[model samples]
Target: MAKAYWVATYRSVTDPDKLAAYAKLSGPAINAAGGRILARGLPSQVYELGLEQRTVLIEFDSVEQARAAHDSSAYQEALALLEGGAERDIRIIEGI
Candidate 1:
């Protein structure tokens, strides 16, 4: 199976504390589920019609593993902490 990637774009961040908490908890959860952070940072540049947003890319061994990471209890806890703290667009895609 092709690898899977978790792509997340932070549209807005309202609570830095919650964001920090989520990051701390989610890291170990993702690692336990076989996910690796590929890239994470504010976009260095944007093209036409682009909106400024922080982007994150995480790779997983497979689509199933990616899904598992998202559904894991540790990640879920982080998600709860992040609720209403930010607006984010997150997805998992199969790598080519």
Candidate 2:
């Protein structure tokens, strides 16, 4: 199976404290589910339509694994903490 990459790009953050709280729990939850964090935080540089925003990348063994992690109860809890905190675009991409 192809490896899967989970990506999250933050468009805007309205509540820093809430986002911080979500991060604290989400990190552990994702790690426990066999997701390896590849990169996170603001981009070093931006070009074209890209904006200087926070981005996160995580790797999983397969698409199934990535979906499972996202659907897991632990991750759900973490997600709940992020509600109304920020606007983000998230997706899972299969590796080449």
Local distance difference test, per candidate? 0.92, 0.97
Q: Which lDDT tens digits does candidate 1 get at residues 1-96?
A: 999999999999999899998899888888888999989989889999987899999999999999989998888988898988899999999999
Per-residue lDDT tens digits for candidate 2, residues 1-96, read: 899999999999999999999999999999999999999999999999999989999999999999999999999999999999999999999999
Runs in model 1 lying further than 4 Å from the true structure: none
11, model 2: CA deviation in Å? 0.5
> For residue 40, what is the lDDT in candidate 1?
94
After superposition, candidate 2 runs with Cα above 4 Å error: none
Q: Lowest summed lDDT over 10 consecutive residues: which window, candidate 1?
A: 24-33
Clashing residue pairs, backbone N/CA/C < 3 A, model 2? none
lDDT, candidate 2, equals 0.97
Error of 1 at 77 (Å): 0.9
TM-score of 1: 0.95
Q: Highest TM-score: give the candidate number.
A: 2
